[model samples]
Target: MKATVYEGPRSVAVKEVPDARIERPTDVLVRITTTNICGSDLHMYEGRTDFEEGRIFGHENMGEVVAVGDGVDRVRVGDLVCLPFNISCGFCRNCEKGLTAFCLTTPDNPKMAGAAYGFADMGPYDGGQAELLRVPYGDHNCLVLPEEARERQSDYVMLSDIFPTGWHATQLACVQPGDTVVIYGAGPVGLMAALSATLKSASKIMVVDRHPDRLALAEEIGAIPIDDSKVSPVDQVNEQTDGLGADRGCECVGYQAHDPQGHEHPNLTLNNLVQSVKFTGTIGVVGVFIPQDPGSPDKLYKEGEIAFDYGLLWFKGQTIGNGQANIKAYNRQLCGLIQAGKAKPSWIVSHELPLDKAPEGYQHFDARDNGWTKVLMHPDGGSHN
Candidate 1:
């Protein structure tokens, strides 16, 4: 099988690798149809993380089950399914409580509670960016899609990660119906956050970013776009909310956040969120903030430390929620919205290429090239709607 292997910093190659097959009684082998190149994957692509050179690099995946282990009872061959980025055993204590992202059974490291396929320091599981993927604990990990899944692979594939993750951001911020919400970053996840807020009936939605294309996408979905390059994002958010600040805020840019001049600031979005959200308001941070950032320009970031305005956060009595999204918690409901034609997260997709073209997709997305908002790869060259 040909898989996208991480070669080094800002480099990837489509290399012929050994076929992925069922390795355990609980495993399911899937013939991957659609997979995504996520922004988080860029962290590894840029050599920011300790990702191994030979490892595959995709976590957003969906496909048809080609084979299943004897222990798998619920999933069957020929069933179209979308696998969550997190791989968890259903019987773990965390899994029982719907905290599948922090499941105790998947991670090999005793100190780490969560595991993701092809992610740095997550686990040993290979990703679904190739022709085949071996899914562990298949009965628990696979979210079976509806009969209409094949026609909407581009949309349904999002249920694997960004869709649920964006919804999770709103859940963390405690976004209520008719509440005013401000979101930082207009990337795919941030755009999805705006979409989620719209579906939840937010009275006002403001999205901040320097990219004109991304901000335009947010505006297309009824969100007010704040171009930080032209105006201070903090001032814009305050101005939009009549100086009271937004009722809720979300941080979707993570640690790789930068100014319009291309200077990286590890704490840029957090401080922006703290200052933009009203007193006593809630904030949710779903962006990836690693424990250590060896490649960051800031000295403090070398140790994964960010110096944000925590004093003001305390004085304002604002609450913050941060972590990886428990995708299983929201995927089912989000999938229902897609099936009912109420939501179409695929609107952000900007490119669709064959599996062999993944390296090109990664290069363009990494550069944040014009019109390269999102890229989906089809391993089987299947038509995507």
Candidate 2:
């Protein structure tokens, strides 16, 4: 198989690698059609984490099942399926409770509780950024797509990560119809969070970001764009909500949060969320914050200890919910919305290249190039909408 191999900091290349094959009865072999380069992958791509070299680098994936293990009864060969970023055994206690992201059965380390393809410290499973992928717990992990999936791979593929993750943010923040919601960051996940808030009938949706391209995307979906580069984001949100703060807020920037000057502040977004939201409102965080950030200039961030505003939070009586999205818990319903022509996440996709061009895609995306919002790679030359 040819895969996008991570060589080092800000470096990747397409190289011939060992073929991925079914090694267990529950495994399924997929001929990957569409795979995505996610914002989370940048953590490894930028050398911010301890991601090993020579590993593949993709987690958002969808494809045609080429072969199914004998133990796989539901998913079959020739079925088009989208695999969630999380890999888990469905019979585990967490999975039984719909907390598949924290499943106790799939991590490489027994002390850990979750697993993801090609992610650092997640699992030993290879990612789907190649011509082929080996799916574990085939029947449990594969979300079989409808026949119409052949025409909408761009939208369906989002069910693997961002769309569900955005929806999960709203769920965590307790977004209700007629509620005023404010979102931090205007990246793909943040844009998806804006979209999710729109679908949930939020009365007012405000998206904060410095990028003109990303803020423009949020505006396209009817969200009020707050350009932090021009003014204070918290002030803008307060102005929009008549100084009451938003009813709900979401933090989507994670540990990489930075100012216009490009100085990284791991606690920037969380504290901003606290100040931007109402006194008794809820805050949902879906950003990627790891346990340790060795590359951080701040010593506390080096130890993964963010100086959060717990005193302000306690005084305001605000609530917070943070973690990885339980993708399996929402994929089915989100898929139905796509199938019914109610949602189209492909609107954010900015580039689609063949597998060999993955290196270019990563370079542009990691640099945060203008208009390079989301990039998708086609391994088998399939173009989905």
Clashes of each: 0, 0
Q: What is the per-residue lDDT of model 2 for residues 1-385, given as tens digits with 9 covering 90 to 100?
A: 8998999999999999999999999999999999999999998999999999999989999999999888889998999999999998999999999999998999979899999999999999899999999999999999999999988899999999999999999999999999999999889999999999999999999999988999999999999999887999999999999999999999989999988898999999999999999999999999999999999877899999999999999999999999999999999999999999899999999999999999899999988999999999999876878
Q: Which window of ten consecutive residues has the lowest lDDT sum in model 2?
A: 376-385
For each candidate, give its TM-score against the true structure. Answer: 0.99, 0.99
Write the residue-wise lDDT of candidate 1 on 21-66 in tens digits: 9889999999999999999999999999999999998999999999
User: What is the model-wide C-alpha lDDT for candidate 2?
Assistant: 0.94
> What is residue 56's positional error in candidate 2, in angstroms?
0.7
Q: How well does candidate 2 match the true structure, expressed as C-alpha RMSD? A: 0.7
The lDDT of each candidate is 0.95, 0.94
Off by over 4 Å in 1: none
Give the TM-score comparing model 2 with the true structure, all chains together. 0.99
